[model samples]
Target: MSTARKHDPISVQDYLAGEAHSDQRHEYIAGVVYAQAGGTNRHNAIATNATVALANQLRGTGCRAFNSDTKVRIRNAAGTRFYYPDAMVVCRANPPSDSFQDEPVLIVEVISETTRRIDEGEKREAYLEIPSLAGYVLVEQSSLSAVVYQRGRQSGGDQGFQRSIVSGLDDVIQIDEIPLELTLRELYEDVELAEPDSTDRS
Candidate 1:
């Protein structure tokens, strides 16, 4: 899914150069570049709350939490793709000091109505290609629910991602990539959510 801006297929180098100076963020898929859409206040709040919580927990630890500014380079069946996740965690001893992280252990994306399918379908499939990635989280903005795809410990290789949907304010998401836990309360702290509708149960 693309927003208002899109460009003819460009080289990775050109994309990188342009993105460095561009005020807006863009994702490079193969050669085509797509502009990132702006988030709502609720979306921004969720991302910020998650980042702050993760960052504070990761302090003094080798693992680090990164906000949307950091790009994640992914290699998937489709091709080379670069995405800016809502928040991510990297645990490499000496991760590349480049504009992106190629080895993120966990990737989190806050989904809106427009990007819901992309986050849960296309993005989830692509993110699992990262060998170091053990978890991919999708947070819903319209409701208090989350979907998680976590790699199974006993699974042979990169082929064992298990999906689970978590709901309600009291639920907690146990991250397999890092030794950290995220509660729905912590993720949505300070943000006022709408009341759930009786017909909205899914």
Candidate 2:
């Protein structure tokens, strides 16, 4: 089977220190790194649409939301992550340049069939490890569904402990840390379905 940047295994720190101006998105797993294919215009639009919505909702608040351009570092030696998210919101304030975010209140990843399973499965599992993470949201570009996970403690029968998965966007998802009033419709405002040739039409 093919791997996503399997040739070279790098630490989270090493991947961050390097420049990403070369293009091609990348994902980091454990310690290995790999590149991602460019998304179609619709894919790009979905991400942009969500970013704007979140940004607008978060304005004036101390919280800050970022597009894929921002690097999310976690559990590394210093700052930066092996993989960058499609969209993210941080309630802890921005970090200094050259350093990645150590505290993130919310993380959002746009689901792609190619990576959807992993994003909702393996990637999700990895995100749950972040101590400062309050929520993780997934926006499905296909059905325009948003799956949200929130931080809190829940009673699990005799074994009560920490829990997540606050609510979903089958109706409309709201992220508590990121202004707590955003709706899924805003994230899909201008998004359209992909064509047969995979071209995004206006």
Candidate 3:
């Protein structure tokens, strides 16, 4: 993401108004707006696979899965920010007119070379502040792997989070929060991955 403007801080109301009529999507961080870059073929495939899998499993359960077009709003001491996650699951429905969701049970982000820093650092930090978020997932575009952060039951806040890694196509990620399981094979389906580098060991 790159800064869209360099002017003084803009109000959330003004940002929303501009977004409604804008041709491109931008993520709002506090008062600054950052233009979102288009995803690669693999990025789009992975995001679509996850969204479709979640949406299918969530049917008739009152929970809905959303694609990158939907924004997740986070407000905390770090200030108000709006991010477009690759995929998200919201158990509680938002109003029909709302453009963003404040309460999401699960959030997924497909990370690439350009987005790895913000997706794993700033975005992760801001998302952990949401009391309603039960799980945050970072999917790697370069390989068949994922890093999941689940909120521990023993405590609250960021300290109560537990991180786990799931790698390989045969592994499955069990999201107990939403009671759903996703396999790496399904997530990487139709996506072309790079060949692993072979090391010379004598």
Q: All candidates' TM-scores?
A: 0.89, 0.77, 0.91
Tens digits of lDDT, candidate 3, 155-183 = 45344678999999999888787788889
lDDT of 1 by residue, 37-98 (tens): 67767778889998998899899988999999899888766778899999999988334558
lDDT of each: 0.82, 0.64, 0.84
Residue-level lDDT tens digits of model 2 in 37-86: 66677777878887787788788887777887776666644333455677
Among the numbered candidates, top TM-score falls to 3
Off by over 4 Å in 3: 4-7, 154-159, 194-202
Summing lDDT over every window of 10 consecutive residues in candidate 2, give the lowest-scoring window.
157-166
Better model by TM-score: candidate 1 vs candidate 3: 3
Off by over 4 Å in 1: 1-5, 93-97, 155-159, 194-202
Separate clash counts for every candidate: 0, 3, 0
lDDT of 1: 0.82
Worst 10 residues of 3 by lDDT: 193-202
